[model samples]
Target: MKARAVARVLGKHVVMIVLMMFWLSVLVFCLSRMAPGDPLQSFYGDAVQSMSTGELEAARHRLGLDAPLWVQYEKWLSGVAQGDFGMSLKYKRPALEVAGPLIGNTLILGGAAYALVFALAIGMALICVRYEDSWIDRTLCAAGTVAFYTPAFWLGTMLVLVFSVNLHWLPGSGAYRPGMAGDVADRMRHLVLPLVVMVASHVWYYACMIRNRLLDEVRRDYVLLARSKGLGRRRVLMRHCLRNVLPGIVSLMAISVPHVLSGTYVAETVFNYPGIGLLSVSSAKYHDYNMLMLMVMLAGFLVIVSSILAQAVNEIIDSRMKGAERGGV
Candidate 1:
């Protein structure tokens, strides 16, 4: 029975993801087709300008761009179903092939920044909770608020100016120095500015949420009962309040994946990091439909999957959620 219930839940999530991806693909395909741009320019560059009408038509036919919009989408969708993402007009390569390494770079940069942001947020939240309404708490709150409101691009640019332009302390762009790709130190240097931007733009928001949640939890009747039973404030918070609030924290983290992912993209663009974020920008600018489609679909998949996983985790962490699911089922 348990196995059947789990299978039912998995089946539902799978259907939801498939439907979402179908709609997302249709939307992106239609929008990209309707957008004003000559995809030939992305493919042929300056030569596109020199091509005669016959030559242009031949080129379009060769690239399958001469087909009707719906037909083109059908063909593209068929190719996608077969694990073929088609060619990138801009890069003159398989869309996934061009994006594969960039995806890894994005994972590394975004993953590092994400982990660091949560770590700092959790630490700061604990500090604020301990300090309560003291000067330290007020100071952190003010700083976090300011950081939260700061635009990512502006923050990244400022960091670049201060650390890269003026002080010459860090490499301003790319994942690493060109020839120093194998050097972990060089890679870390390049990551510093982008990481700072990502962390600053996101950490405070989560920190404030956590701080508020912890404060509220500490005032609960159960927490008071724990304290009345001769528990120290620190012990009560760590053993009772913090533990009780963790499931919510996990839920919050999962819900924020999309938000945090957007911040990572912004950071990537500002830093000129060779990641899917930068590739997405260039693909859109040049009307690289295949590349754009892949990026959008990949991001959408991540968002949908993360939300599903979060729900599943919540059900596991809280028996009430499982009961509710069972009742609904």
Candidate 2:
């Protein structure tokens, strides 16, 4: 029975992933192809006029710009099937090679930032639920709203100013020192500011979510009955109340996964971090179409995968709880 539940969830995720990939591919193809000026011509600049007609044709052929859109797309799809995104027209290297490291960096930063956020947010939410609208709860909620609306870039700047520029407590920017003795320490230092910026901007969002869920759960019949049974608040909250709250948490987590993936572009680019967002901007400026396509597609894929994972978790949890109740043993 457990195996069947797992299989069902996995099947749904697979279907969703396929749909997401298709949508992403279509978007990538249309947007770049529709952009003003031919990419081949854009790559050559004014020198296009200076080139002999034969030279121009050679350049077009070399880049497969001469192929019809359908044909080009077909070729691209074939390469994609083989796990090749093709070579970058501008970077002059395999598109995947350039994007792989940067994607890893962005994921690392985003994962760490969100992990801290989930922990802090849940902790704060529990506190607020325990306190239930005291000065501290109201104050933090007020401050959190202000922080949530502030642009990530501005918040990041202030953090750098306070922690790095003024106090000299943290490095202002960059991933790590080139000749750092150990990668682990250097990475931890690099993560500090960006993660702080991420936490500052978004922690409130999750805190509010978890807080609202907590408040609602405590008011429900199960919780009230649990309280009547003389169970401590912590026990009710930790064991019983949270069982209901967690699905919402998982759903929200999944919903934000895409946002988390996309948001990295904003935070990383703002801080000059070595992530796909920064590299993506560079690729766009260079008309590195191949790299840009890969980046966009990859971001989309991650989002789809996140949603799928969320759905699976939901199904599994629901199935298990229902099963337990049915057994009544």
Candidate 3:
């Protein structure tokens, strides 16, 4: 029975992933091809203008751009099924070759930002809940609202100005010092500003969501009973309220991961961080269709994976909630 349940869950997620990939690939391919300006021209530069008609046709054929849109998409889709994303017109390299190094860089920067955001958002939300409409809660809510509305680029620029230029405390941009791969301190110094900017820009939204949810959960009968049973304020909030609130938090965090990864374009560009977000911007500028499509597919994959994980977590938490309701705790 357990095996059957697991299989059923896997099958559901697999179907969702496959259908999502199909539609995403079709939309991405069509939109990329529809964009103005010839990728061949961008790839070849001034030489493209000087080429004979026959030479241009040959170049197009070689790049598979001469094929009909449907045919081109089918061929690309086939390659994608086998984990191939074709070649980068700009770099004359495989898509993976161009994207592989940048993935790790993004994961490092994004992962750190995500961890800080998750931890601090929860902590801040709890504080707000504890204070419960006091001055501190009002102040935090206002600040979080400001942070949410503030453009990431503006925030990043302000950090650079104050910390790097005025205070001389942190590096303004780049991942690390030149030729300092093993210098942990220097690398951390470079990371501090961008990391803070990413965290500050994102934390408030999640914190606010958590605060509202905690407020609602605290009024539930279970929580009231826990307080009546001689549980202290912190105990009731942390043990009874937080436990029930955690699944929602997990779902929210998981859903935000893909968005955070995708949204890093502004932050990464501002910091000159060598991450996939920066790579995507460059690829878009150079009309590197293959690279751009690969990035899209990758982002989709992350969303699908996170969704599956979140569903599993939700199921587990639901079961626990049911058990608690049945006095089986």
Candidate 4:
């Protein structure tokens, strides 16, 4: 029975991932076709504002832009299945080539930002729970609430002003220091401001969620029972309350990863970072439909994977809780 349940859950997860990928593929394709820009004209918009009838028709035929929507989508799907999302007319290169590096950049930024935020949040939550209603707890709560409402773009501007413009501690607003070195230190320096902005945006949000959860758990029956047996406050909170609140936090982190990844678009473009969000915006403005589709697929994939992780964490939590209940532990 256990094996069957596991198999069933895995099967459902796989099916859901496939469905998400398919839906995103179709949605991007259909919407790209629905866009008002003439792909053929936009393709040559720089070269000619006005074209003879024969030239216009030839360009349309070559690019197949005048085809029926369904036919165009079908052709696009066929190319996608073969791992060729067509070429970017503007860039004169494969879309995957353009998307690959940008995705790499995004993952680096997202990973650093989330790691710092999540680690600090858990620690802050523990501190808040340990102090309960003390002055420190109250202060953290007030500060976290304010930070939660703070905008990333504004935060980026402030960081630039204080650290870069005023103090000259870091570069003002761009990804890399121009023409210095291509080494790790150079990359780290470039990443600092954007990463700090993202971390600031996320830490308060996570700390608030975790602190609330831990506070709620610490007041529950299990925690009180643990304390009644003479367990120290640290032991009871860490071994019992924190454990119970952890499942929820783990699930939240899974959801937040996708949110941070997609929501970084504005931040990336604002900061002039060479990440997927900015790249997607550039591709989109230049009518690089292939690259646009790639970004859509990448975001869809991240969401689907996060959903699976959340589901798996929930399963483990429920199983453990049930075991503890049966044992009266």
Q: What is the lDDT of residue 306 in candidate 1?
A: 91
Task: List candidate 3 segments past 4 Å from native.
Answer: 221-231, 326-329
Q: Can you tell me which runs of candidate 2 are displaced by over 4 Å?
A: 1-16, 37-54, 225-232, 320-329
Best by TM-score: 1
12-33 per-residue lDDT for model 2 (tens digits): 7788788779878877886787
Order the candidates by lDDT, highest first — what do you get?
Answer: 1, 3, 2, 4
lDDT of 1 by residue, 1-329 (tens): 99998899889999999999999999999999899989999999999988999999999999999999999999999999999999999999999999998898899898998899889998999899988999999999999999999888888999999999999999899998778778988889889999999999999999999999999998899888887888888888777788878888888888888888898889889999999999999999999999999999999999999988888778777897678789999
Q: Give the per-residue lDDT digits (tens) of candidate 3, residues 57-122.
A: 999998889999999999998898898999998888899999997787788788888999989999
TM-score of every candidate = 0.94, 0.87, 0.90, 0.89
Candidate 2 global lDDT: 0.81
- Compared with the true structure, the alpha-carbon lDDT of candidate 4 equals 0.80
Better candidate number, 2 or 3, judged by lDDT: 3
Q: List the residue pairs that clash in candidate 2.
A: none
How does candidate 2 fare on TM-score?
A: 0.87
Every candidate's lDDT: 0.91, 0.81, 0.86, 0.80
**250 Cα displacement, candidate 4 (Å):** 1.5
lDDT of 2 at 273: 89
Native-referenced Cα lDDT, model 3: 0.86
